[model samples]
Target: MLTSANLLLWAVLQLALLILLQEAFAWWIIAIYALLLLYSATAVLQKRSAASLKLANIVAALLTLALLLNMRQAGVLHFMLQILLLSAILRLFAMRHRHEARQLVWVQYFLIASCFILHQDMLLALVIMLLFGANCYSHYKLFAPAGARLNFTLTGRAVLIILPLWLGMFLLFPRLPPFWQIPNAKIASTGLSDSLDPGSIEQLVQDDRLAFRAEFSGTLPERQQLYWRSYLYEHFDGRTWQVHPQRRQQAVAPPTTAADVATASYRIIAEANQQRNLFALGMPYSSSQGVKIGSGGLIVADKVVSQRFSYSIESALAPLPLQSEREREMNLQLAAGNPKTSEFAAALRQQHNDTEQFIAALAAFFNQQDFYYSLTPPPLGRDSIDQFLFQTRSGFCGHYASATAVLLRHAGIPARVVGGYLGGDWHPQQGYLAVRQREAHAWVEYYSQGHWQHFDPTAAVAPERILQSLDMSLSDDERDMLIPFWQRSSVLQLLSLQLMHLDYYWSVWVLGFDDRSQQDLWRTLRQHIRLIAYSAVAIVLLLLAGMGLWLLHRRRLSKPLPAKQLLLKALKPALKNKAPAQSVSACLNELAKRYPNHAAMLQQLVQYYELAVYAGQPQAEHSLKRLLQQHKSSLAALNRAIKNT
Candidate 1:
């Protein structure tokens, strides 16, 4: 039968594996793992023997094959994780003795550590810490005495002692890049994509999840100025808009001097979206490492952003450079549909010959017409732009931007729809702007005389959206669709905002603390080198003193106590008149007769004392101490009775 200690250790090991891999693995894999754990627990409870090596080998082989087949879909990282978890589980099923499970426990430790690769937020980090503690307990239980239970007090004390050392190492240690980059798993990309279709951005705007955060080095920009451009949709089919293939293949453009002095310098901390496209304002120039300056002043990561990424950028609010002949041609090409909208654009162009005046007229059309911004727009056919312009005037930002870009192109002006975020909630206390997926917006950038100018027809339709937030422009019903029912309460909204603030600080101080932060720490330490050295010396002395005291206490505990001395101390109350050299047996016999209440205990004590002193048995000394303790109150009563007499 398995010992209770072993069973407990087994349970902890399985729990650690589950908690670590639950988020990373497929649901079916996790369900299978849970079922196996249940089976193992049932066998342990029933006192049945562990699975035979043959059965374990069969399961291992099947799981290995399944993982290999899934490797392509899950990627190499998840495949390795699955294999590691499988080995650990199979090892447990095949083991009969606790000692045989030692290697499995170590594997669980590694699995728990690997969880940080996917999750680094504050809440998940705490969960990971608890998993570590559970794994540590399991490892300790492997060599501990049978039936030993976990001592929470000792565990907490150990954590308290080690926490400082952990912090010290984390702060002081030189941060080095990973020795080898782990392959990114196939995760669903989160934000905008290379193509924009009708209702695509409308669906995205309903999601309130955080996309990225920006920390400005200078004064915060105006609400209308925070248009974070991510992707440009140059090619327009009748129904969808996509990035031109040649645009992506073009080389990085040379930096151009800004026409205006207005610039915003900021650092962006973007959540992992599994794409190389990054967010920035107009005409961004970045020298940040691990990022590339793409054509048309676009920023892109050197690799897929499989984790949280940070980059610093300086963006000029001026117009972009003049479009190349190929770019103008690409942006001007339109599908052979929306002829009614084309005729309307051509007539408007005829009324205003100037490019700027034509653009103004297009914006005026959206403003003067009965256009309503709605997340749920009516579906359109092949002539989407024509229908949206005349029949279905209700649409989201994508509809407005698409119609405006199409109108501009029809009027012989090179224009494209820009996909990115619009307004962000600026937390003045935190000094950062939080941009969410709900802020996903689409606008237009038209190539005019010498430069490209940004235009948003949605702003002309609903100016409050640019002036404030999406909520301001939306009705209660539309706003409710974006926010959850639970968060509609005023109290819950305030609480949620506070939690976001806490998370922001955690991300900035902990997850965002990179090699540059370490270098800054080193520089600060060098400036106060003498103070740091003194503090270090003081800490070392204190640690040495604590160790010296602990060693002394241990030495005192290790020294053996003499049996004769212990007997004398135990019987001092009853031996007031006894001779100093009296035989222990005689003394016990006299005491047993005088205090009959403790006669049995006195006799047992004398026997143990003799065994300890003459037979030299260590266990006898322990027995003597225990016997004396059992009869302590009676012996005291005997002493008091003698005193009264």
Candidate 2:
């Protein structure tokens, strides 16, 4: 009942199915899974044979068909995983023959690989190796005689012998990129969007979800200087700000900046936000494949970032060139229907002729007024800009940036809203910065003095929000949930970060090591390979030398064997020349009759010979040798009689 075939079949089926259990499944499907597991346990523990299994087998096939037809809601990979899971479980009930058991081993190999594909946790990967050893032992037991003890030494030797060949192939194989993109399942994430609306960004900032992590080429920048812009909002209705169609349709050209300013290099690992807008410091230009700088100096990913994505960029961190009249006209667009805010802005402009002076005047007004930077701001009527500027005077970065851009546009200053993160929590040990969603912000960029200049009216109202983390600006109530565990306990903080470091290397070397990473790795590996390249070439010579020793050992073991003389001496009287042959026991009986005093000794020698030679028990050979010594005198007499005859 405890057959190795059944053990392996159930083991692979159970482990592989556990991996897929993390996927979204119907409640009824989970019930069926538990039922199948129960059925397998019954067969193993109770030694019960499969009954009415043909009907169950038919039901399994029908279920597979049903899954194929109803998997429109699931991804292709998810569907395939489910189908394999069902079939793996089904095989547990049917491993009754050698052919079927052999097929099950092949299925187990795929199951192990599938587990690695779906997950890369350190503990789980370690578990797979342990399971692999068990599978190898199962293979030995499946073919060995019944009740044979498990032989781990055989499996261990086989793995060691194949290790060198496996390493050589892996290091020398050519890497090729995938032809099609694997569809990523959707992820719930927090980041900037293509458009900005009243309260959209303010509500987003309340979430403490991590956005991205950045590492710089040199010393980290000051908190005030970290402006990671991702989106530029131009067209604004009374309540919402959106991207002008013309903005998205702009010619795919690099953003031009003055060559005089120094540029800094930094790389970022961004979490999947289901948005194509890329975040970077200053105006970024990328040499990474499939990424390009679009209009308004915004970096754009080739597709929705559905996983942790990485890219490198160099930023000038200076004034960007702005010359297109079309861009000027687009940025100046506003809902003329909101006339009250426009009239108020015109009066503020009357006091200053210079654009810089007018911008300063507006900043002075927000500072002088009783404006409160509140997370929970009151909703406005149709004339949102008018209400927010004159009446409410209290909202998040969105309310401040929107009103500032509206006022600047009404004053004949072309301005647009820039959306991105502001600052991040610095990790000195890792030498990186982790930007969170709470750092989401909006500021105004105006085309002034032959270049677009950055301006933030909200910065004038609350400068601490720009100079430090959002927690510094938020009340204790607003920031309680955002507090990191590390801040509360020293031990937890140290342990969490240590685990993060392990995950970083695992992702970089394993999950993220695609064809492109391989090409880059090859360049570095080529130098080391140059040093050890001779080792592989020496394999043939070493094999020859080892084989010579093996042959010498073989000669010593089988030497001085004259087969005819040995056979005659060993088998002569005991295995007679009779027409009808007798077994060793029967031959011993005939010999015992001739020498009655030695009958017990003769029969004992016969039994020993049967165990050592016929039954293939090497452990019994010692007893056989002693019995042969004791029977030498009797056998000599019988041999002389046979010789005379």
Candidate 3:
């Protein structure tokens, strides 16, 4: 049985190895791992009984839980792996014999496997593959072949086969769609929501989650014009607003009048917000596949999307509503307790003959007054509109939109709130758009001149706020998380962006591959099966050829130079052909007395050969042959001299 102190020492060694594996530069992750390893090792070294080990394990588990809490936003796979690492550390403390030590190693394997779920990059995958080899070697060393002589070659071959098989299983196994929703390990939202309150916009500024991505087919929409409308909030609760409650499906009116209906089609690939709202650009005419567009013009997924989901929609900038009296009545309804605003609307209606002029006056009121667009808006009292307009002039998109809509009602104009993201990051290389949560905005649409007219009141206050990103407008303190110029230009960041594009495409084509994408894949495969098959075969052959070449290199490492090169004694040869001369130095010394000039040349040639071959420099093939031929005469003369002597 291993003594407690020795076991503790072993635990510390294993943990240091693990810390090195994590590549965590964070002193805390390293320090915590080191401290725990030391404590566990010390407990074992002290010969603490099983009870003490168990108690130590319990404390380790608690510490793991605490660390896990810190990584709550890291996702389920990350949290589990961290806990497994802690469990391994705890196991290290308890290891009394070889069996327990092996179990601790298995825990390490589990931790390593979980890393794939967090980072699936090619480099990380390769590192994990190597770690797998290391694991196999450790296992072989510990548990030799039973009753059979173990050889390095056979053991290595077994490991090579096993590792690929394991990787194949991981990649090929169909992960059954989760029957139940896994609790979002991240406490924060991944994308913008349909709902908007006072603090909604402010909170988004702190999050760095990707909201939606757009790949344009033709000329991209200008940043100023790219108002990708998502949700429509018709009903308000004096404080916050929500999309008019799930309404019953009704038949939509088909298009009648056709005028300037140029369609701007887009395929949106969005990460799930766990909300029902499936976002699309304004005036969506037609949609493809899984989405069911409601009569109220709200596009929703047939099922709640928990993973990345993709859908295509065609939108037109052309006007949608053509004078619906029923829709106008719905838009005009005022909330129950706004008597003062209602009275003001009656007076304004009687005073103004022109509705357009009255609307213009209200817009000018917002523009001319000291109203400001701010992410962090002050608390609004019970009379939300009054507090916003009179007391707290600083507000977000919601405040501007809400106050505008309420003012429109007071001026006897039918209006409602439109919620959506404003702009997207234009990737010049990938030619795609990435929309973030911080792009979430709210605007107003009034029923004017027989149609719903989009009017942005935020533009009235801060015109740039409607067009440009808030990051551009924020103070240095607010822009803390904004990627710095140097950081953005870094090689790593560029590489990361490229990888994200690849991942986005992977998600679009593979992860989010629904019935539609499957059909598309099937069609393509059917069209080019023979060519595809031949290409695949060629790729496999090339890979095999490379593998064979690598194996040959590994084997040839210990071999002697060609015999022809060995004969070259005087002429300076290519560096690759020169063999080690320390043992042969004595042989050269005897020849030096008879042919001292040739001895110096032979030594120089040998040195050059050693430097080229052993020092890892490239060797030219023809140069070696030329070297052998040039020294042929000198070598023969030397041989004759030796024989005669």
Q: Number of the top candidate by TM-score?
A: 1
In model 2, which regions exceed 4 Å deviation?
A: 2-77, 86-172, 179-190, 206-209, 336-340, 378-382, 484-487, 511-517, 524-645
**Candidate 2, residue 582: how far the Cα is off, in Å:** 37
Pairs in clash, predicted candidate 2: none
Worst 10 residues of 1 by lDDT: 1-10
Off by over 4 Å in 3: 1-190, 246-259, 288-290, 302-305, 319-330, 336-358, 448-451, 471-519, 530-645
lDDT of 2 by residue, 1-645 (tens): 346455645655565456444453455566676677677667767766653558568869887877777577666665666676667666666545566666666666676666665556556677787766666556666677877886569757977989988865555567666788667543334577767888898778867666888878887877777988888889887778887778888875566556786677887777767788888777665547656777778888898776567787888887667748888888887776668778888888888879999989988988899987877789988888888887888888888999999989998899999999998888787677878888889998999986778998877788778886676776776676566545568788777667666655555555565567777768887878956678866887899989999999999886632322232365476455743555556766776797687678767776766676668676556776665666778667767765765
Sort by TM-score, top down from the best:
1, 2, 3
Clash tally for model 2: 0
Query: TM per model?
Result: 0.81, 0.70, 0.62
Residue lDDT tens for model 1, 558-585:
7545886777676665554678698777
Compared with the true structure, what per-residue lDDT tens digits does model 3 show for residues 355-460? 7777777678889989876666678778877777777788877788888888787676878888878887888787779888777778888886666777888777
Query: Which sections of candidate 1 miss by over 4 Å?
Result: 1-23, 44-49, 147-157, 534-645
Q: Candidate 1 or 2, higher TM-score?
A: 1
Error of 2 at 57 (Å): 6.3
TM-score of 1: 0.81
